[model samples]
Target: MKKLILSLTLAASVVASPALSQTVRIGTEGAYAPYNYVNDNGELAGYEIDLGNAMCAEAKLTCEFVTNEWDSIIPNLIAGNYDMIMAGMSITEDRKKTIAFSDEYYPAEPSRFMATAGAKFDFTALKGLKIGVQGATMHAAYAEENLAAGNTILSFETFDQAVADLAAGNIDLFLADGDPLNNVAEASKGAMVAVGEGIRIGDGMAVGLRQKDTDLAATLNKALTSLKKKGVVDKLIKVYFKDGPFYSN
Candidate 1:
């Protein structure tokens, strides 16, 4: 009888092993609010977190969230530290060469410049100005390629730090996605304001996967398409953004 019970337990364990091993680990930067952030309760929370869970449900894969710094997010994924990234990372040609991207989950929100309230400058000729941007991002690339002629491009590890420098007058201008800048402007209470017209930057934001993981990328792309078709992505965007610049009507 004991042998029979042991055999049954072993069979159940064998049957459950694959389910346990099927978890898809997702990487994100817990610093970008509205998209992804560490909430007041110290848990990961935001649109991407909610959206990623939905995608996992649609894909029928168990999902695990892993917080990583923005600079290392891609390198860690390439190193097999996580199965995918859903960190509001934009899909760009340069990045596409290094990693695979799912179909855009979010539309291409425009990039904008934020400066201390009452600051002024020539957007056309920003030479000799100090511009802050988060390193390794499309914003950084844009600033370097277009705005770096005679400007001091200060690259920080996170957007919040760049905003901090802007607040302190340490930098002349800060360039970043409009979502975070909107959040900062509201929180700053007139300390900062969007300076110029939004600059169209990259394609859009999507899931980042290792180049060789085409199968996983396809799975994510299909799931994202379903989410878009079902209007779940739009609903989630409304829940977080609520008529904010990143959300369309």
Candidate 2:
């Protein structure tokens, strides 16, 4: 009888271990400053990184972040390389077809055109000039649809590269998030200035999860809502954006 009980206990432990050991792996573009950039020590740090750790602590789950490139973030998540994507990915109807999103965590920030001071042109007045955008981004899609059919469209793998090309006179304009463009503008020292009013691509960013994982999404939303109610989210934003390098750089 003792042998029989021991065997049953061992079987139960084997059956329950996987669920108990599950960890949430998050994919992020560790290059987007003030969002999820990598620090000098090679650790991911930013508003998203801080928020991700907060969510994990609230949900009582172990969390890890993997640096991922922007273009293939979703595909790699779908491939099971990670359980969630915490990059500042906009929640669009088109992206919803493949993956589910948690409730938005940030306010909608628009994308605008930026160019060197002397070369800045009215976006509406650009009869035929080049526009640079990061490849596979919603900015690229918006520019393609709204601009003239023959307008020069230059695509780069990273925003920094596109900014470099624009500064070098290889491209006439660049479309990117307002915050990052703010950084570029400062770096340009009066050379780069944001043009025309920006366009809202979608609501704020959200965490992406595989379809049918509605349970995790529900947990995340609840935890996030609780965190916001507790003022943790606001506090984090203030700490990082208010007096940090985000404003200066």
Candidate 3:
């Protein structure tokens, strides 16, 4: 019994140590705009990028971001290739089984819809319309749950590809956050529009952290809280998404 107790204590100590911490690599889907996406120069930009840099500063740690495919971001996180995920990932009970989340720092309504102009439709009225979402996203899960079982649900890697498929009439509609959908719609010159009423999923957006690094998660949360207080988060939201629906005009 004494030996077991000592082992448990030692294990706890290892989990709590920061020196054992890595370079704090963060994972993001560089394909999702406003939240995270590649800029014109092929550099990472968006709210997550800004918030992540601030968090690193607050934590007093060096950090780097890797553009990862959305479908496998969490899986790769568990595999130890990265330290945290901040791709506008939502805090959901379904995901909590494998990884932990910091307190929700940025929460907003999940994106939805992909209908052509002059097509009057309601998501509830369409009992058999097919929908597309990025695989492994909260939007994908929501589509699976809300849409009819007979309604086909497709998954894609990038939002741009999903929008392309929609424009080609390959799928009935695409679902994602409002910011990306709006960006895609404008870029397509009105080929698609988010028609159905938007839906909210889970509590809010949060950083996905390895289960073992609760301390690191706490540190990130502290940074997020500080940013929230200093109006940095709100300011960034306005700058990036002033004309978007999620933010006021």
Candidate 4:
């Protein structure tokens, strides 16, 4: 009787152990569509969400999606708010100082300017124009470093707001990733148009992990490589982007 009781207790402990719980928390900004967004059903959905789920499955991890603001995504990651970030975040040397990134899953794409239809403007020769960009992003950084001298660069908490300002004529132009900008243009029904060629920015997109979480980073890297080999990543990209500019190299 004593032996049976001990065996039952051990079994229960195993069932309750953390090792048996393989949940991986994935963080993302649910506002960037084609990458991540809240759908009509009020559920998180997009290419990154699909890719994250696939990677987690390939890595034998149970993933739970968590929505976070873009500005605080990195800080929250460092604070243990989530185990990984799959919010279309680009990998860059500056970000590398604080967080590690998985191997590039999405190839580096270009950024472009969008303005009201029939508005002729030179992106290279900007002067006395109000440009909008999402705060704390590469677009904002590029605008500040390259365009702020002669132009008015406005920062917003979300890309949607920046695009809204552009549509409302509050801003002269808005800069953002080609894929999302293309989506905005298509949805705008000729209300907006791309102003210039895609401007290449930053390294490719990848999963972000804490600097100290080397093991998790390695696991994600391996899984991403496997997914790439299996053509799962390419398939998802095609499904979302089709003949779009964003693609895997």
Estimate the TM-score of every prediction. Answer: 0.92, 0.87, 0.84, 0.91
Better of 2 and 3 by TM-score: 2
How well is each residue in 149-193 modelled by candidate 1, as lDDT tens digits? 899999999888998888989999999999889889999899899
Lowest lDDT block of 10, candidate 3: 240-249
Tens-digit lDDT track for model 4 on 1-249? 999999999998888876765778999999999899999999999999999999988988889999999999999999998999999899877788899998987888888899999988866688999999999888888889899998899999998999889999999889998889989999999999888888887889989999888998888889988888888988988899887444345
For candidate 3, the C-alpha RMSD (Å) to the true structure equals 9.5
lDDT of each: 0.90, 0.84, 0.80, 0.89
Q: Please say which candidate is ahead in TM-score: 3 or 4.
A: 4
Give the lDDT ranking, best first.
Answer: 1, 4, 2, 3
Candidate 2 lDDT tens digits, 3-94: 99999999999898778858889999898878889899988899899999999999988898998899999999999999999887888887
Give me the overall lDDT of model 1.
0.90
Off by over 4 Å in 4: 1-17, 244-249
RMSD of 4: 3.6
Task: Provide the lowest-lDDT 10-residue window in model 2.
Answer: 240-249
lDDT of 4: 0.89
Look at candidate 2 and give me any clashing residue pairs. Answer: none
Clashing pairs in 4: none
Show pairs that collide, candidate 1: none
